[model samples]
Target: MQIYPAFHIDKKITDAADEALRKAQPALKRIDEVTDYNQQKMLAAFIHCGVSESHFAASTGYGYGDRGREVLDQVYAQALGAEDALVRYNFVSGTHALTVALFGVLRPGDTMLCVTGLPYDTLQSVIGLTGDGNGSLKEYGIHYRQVDLKKDGTPDYEAIEHAVQPDTKMVYIQRSRGYSLRPSLFVEDIEKIAAIAKRRAPNCIVMVDNCYGEFVQKEEPVAHGADLMAGSLIKNPGGGVAPTGGYIAGRKDLVESCSYRLTTPGTGREIGCTLGNNRELFMGAFHAPHVTGEALKTAVFTSALFEELGYAVTPRWDEPRADIIQAVLLRTREALIAFCQGIQKGSPVDSFVLPEPWGMPGYDCQVIMAAGTFTLGASVELSADAPLRAPWAVWMQGGLNFHSARLGSMLAAQSMLEKGFLG
Candidate 1:
């Protein structure tokens, strides 16, 4: 039966979606289990922190002794299994939070090692991988080095061990797959890397760009040995409700150092004002695990449906997932555009808009994006984006609910079919 009577979806596509749902049952069930565990963890943190109506009250200028801000940090720290956390609406993005951690921990003579190869496009300039060194880590005199991933797109453990130096102050790991075809790093992988780095240099900090990986698994990177981790609130912890912010959680000392960087060296985390954002931030954190589960189900369904349609999908439907991203190799420019446009069409907001490829800043080439979310640029709200380059693939993620996400995936297929991009 055609489930979406309001829109046109080919019978073949509908049938494929049904079969895909069937194939995704096991994976969906696992997502539910993880969601339950994470939800419980979040609940415990809230209750233990004594989160109440008072903590939701806003603060103003200098925000001296803001109870909500302070308790927000405690709640996040407890939830992520970290010694401390810095949660702030001032953090413009996940990259900003990571930058604070990097600058806060490393000195001019120190070295930073990346075990996950090159980072996301937005981080290229920050790390001086692209563009002039200007204000990047490179310009600040801190040495940066990367050990490329192996041929199979997995971390090169041997290379990482050899790469760590006596002067290495930080070992970086990006938990998400980014724009690459590599697998997302799980907490177990983080544990091994942390162990290896600490063994080589006892003082080295293992930092994870936890971005899209938050709440997707039963445990976070901090629980498995990461000394520090950072992520954007808009992505996962936002629960599709947090207006804007980011978080950094990990070792107490390291988190303290990051706080200094986030504000001023002397003031640190003590003075940030929550203004009118405390309630939504708290509410969002409370709902994150469940929202993340919905996104995971959407990703699994996408993988299964795309596979049924003969496209290659990473972490195929039944495979274990470490993040919400679902990469589908459309293999052609037209198909990619069609898929993104279709996703836009299925969005609750701005459904009539058409997305086009443009030279977005912080990227090497033209990139296309489709996001009609309530929150701008929220990847946790069913958005598809891809760089216009070789091996064209669309990275899709986020869906507040499974039903809406499933319909979006089917609409993507329908668009491709109408354009004859699908066989």
Candidate 2:
């Protein structure tokens, strides 16, 4: 891919960014290491499933006797190193999958402890942390509480040790940043929290919300200490290929319980139609490792470019990445708006339109999002989103290829510069 020749952006800025990327050579080399590990796991999953063309056939009527559906579950479970997995189109979104996992495990009298700070905005209502939604876990009598991260953005280990009440049935850890300034949690972080939970609340379950995090690391949170982990097919696990789905992989009993909630008690994993989705799932799985590596490289390029332009960047270029996010702090409202507009201008779709922060669902403040992806709202594709909070940072991630990511990243920098937001 041509780095600086084609984009109609400032040559001086692109030249500096090109130099910065050259300096990130060591980090780029590490992507192959991460990709190789994920490839091994994904291959094992495919081999374990003995995936074939017949598995793509759709099932109808109570979705019983669906071989594809069953094997796909096994595939995900194996990939995540879990005893079992629930892979289902029945899950409409990531939030839906998380809801099923939460409701399936905890009872009316149990407590759910969020070790990380507040969860993604969408989860607030699901947990009844805000609105008294009737179908929420809180409305169902499940108690909820969260311990915010320390000033450094790491989990407050001391707070966790103090908060693990005897009744804390589940210890929830969010692996991705989830619109927070905190860096994504690593496998070691999961292991640390898991050990504490095991000692403090022996009977409690440790679950990781493995959203934007899948495949970026050699080891998963489940391999570290998490008893269960979940993510959406439209995110990293989807490889930009899956039309729609979500997965929950973990201990057999817990997975079975989630399956029960996904379908029905007696029919657990026995039903659900693949409905011609197996092809996408299987192909997506096969492509995930390579595609994830591409995203990682794009993240590195983005971080380096933004930092070169005198902007503060989260998870700075050289840091180990647990997920695909690369946040750039524009430090002003207009800069943030221009940066998003740059992304929209660079998109393959809807390039002519402009994006502005406005009241969006599932968020308290006005937010801005830009994506010109083939798949609607796919985080695994090139996209940027940020809320109208202080520092005016925009979290940018996902590019199908280096060429696209390079062009997009340069355009964003150029936008900020033209608007005089940079030095």
Candidate 3:
């Protein structure tokens, strides 16, 4: 029984995006010519699971020789404008890459100012404020300070400037809201932060945690003067190709240092150079631009649909998108739970598993995840979560394949409607 009417899309939005695609046909055709379909299919399968061609290569010990590195270099140059880039199947997650970058660049006694307040939930332990003390950065003796976001979710630049100390070695800005329901920082905002870092601590490095936010915006953090930008292979950049890994891109020196940390202290990027899942990484990067664009469109569609149903959506249609995430404020725990259950039932993961609020490892409050089957925040599938906060705001993240995202959103709305959540 469908409780809500079928989704009615605004033809204007779709028409405009279609026109833009048509205008960019030359570039699209070029991308099509360079991309290998066999590799793209394999990459897509790998992203859906936890395995890929890279996993097979590594297991068989058929290393990613110099040729693989060369391919990576060419790929980075074409896609990210990075002079040098390293893609390893061993990074495991975005946080792992961030750890490598932080350890590689900041030495003991150096200070790291968290300009974005407490980063994503998982990073809390890594930055030394929480957990059982097994994380990096803080374990390496790096000090940390935070500058909280203002009422509207933007960073307080004055507070950030005030937090900079004489020994500040780096400033970290996470573009994605992570577990927080706040909106992501924009490129202009990042530029402002960079400006403040340069003026306050001239020698300090400015790094961005560019996870789910990748490719969503035209201007990357690196383009706006970020010393380094880090993200996980399973997120936006993987584009459905990388089986398991992470990436770090930035200035030549900083990337080189990260390579050293990734391998051994003395061994540089060239050292421990094993051929990673080149096929997946390469194919993923190739498809990233298209996949990301589709995901953004799905997000826009979901936002508009939810808003029409009377749910409060962040960043209305007239506003610019912060990231691909589309948050719908449910306003009550019962409604939130119903919405999540609907999403879970509609997901590609376990459809029978019902989500409930439970105390997650690092978070301060009980949290609920509706279809995040891959241990952490795996965007390869659709999922929704809500921190157990008052007013019960639910945060919906991801839309791996837009088709699945659209169906799941409709089901979610239907579920809510059945529960009398809608007018």
List clashing residue pairs in candidate 1: 382-398
lDDT of 2: 0.86
**Per-residue lDDT for 1-423 in model 1, tens only?**
358479889989989998999878988999999999999999999999999999888899899989999999999999888999999988999899989899989888788899999998888898888898899999999888999999998989999989998768999999999999999999999999999999999988999999999998888999998999999999999899998899999999999998888889989998877888999999999999999999999999999999999999998999999999999999999999999999999999999999999999888899999999998998899999999997999999999999888899999999999999887
By lDDT, who's the top model here? 1
Which candidate achieves the best TM-score against the true structure? 1
Cand. 3 Cα-lDDT: 0.71
In candidate 3, what are the lDDT values of residues 1-423, reduced to their tens digit?
Answer: 122344432343334334433343453343233334423433443344344344334322423354555455545543554556677778988888988888889888888888887788878788777877775667878888888898878899889888876568899999987756677887788989998998888888999998877766655788886888888877777776667788888888888888888877565665444444567776777667566655665566566667666778875543566566768888888898889988887776686788888998878898888974443456744778888787587667666666667667766776777778866
Candidate 2 least-lDDT 10 residues: 1-10
Model 2 CA RMSD to the hidden true structure, in angstroms: 1.5
The CA lDDT at 178 in model 2 is: 77
Candidate 3: where are CA atoms >4 Å away?
Answer: 1-64, 271-276, 372-377
| lDDT against the true structure, each candidate | 0.93, 0.86, 0.71
If ranked by lDDT, best first, what sequence of candidates would result? 1, 2, 3
TM-score, every prediction: 0.99, 0.97, 0.82
Write the number of the candidate with greater TM-score, choosing between 1 and 3.
Answer: 1
**Which tens-of-lDDT digit does each residue in 129-176 have in candidate 2?**
777687999889999988889998999999999999866899999989
* Clash pairs detected, candidate 2: none
Off by over 4 Å in 2: 1-6
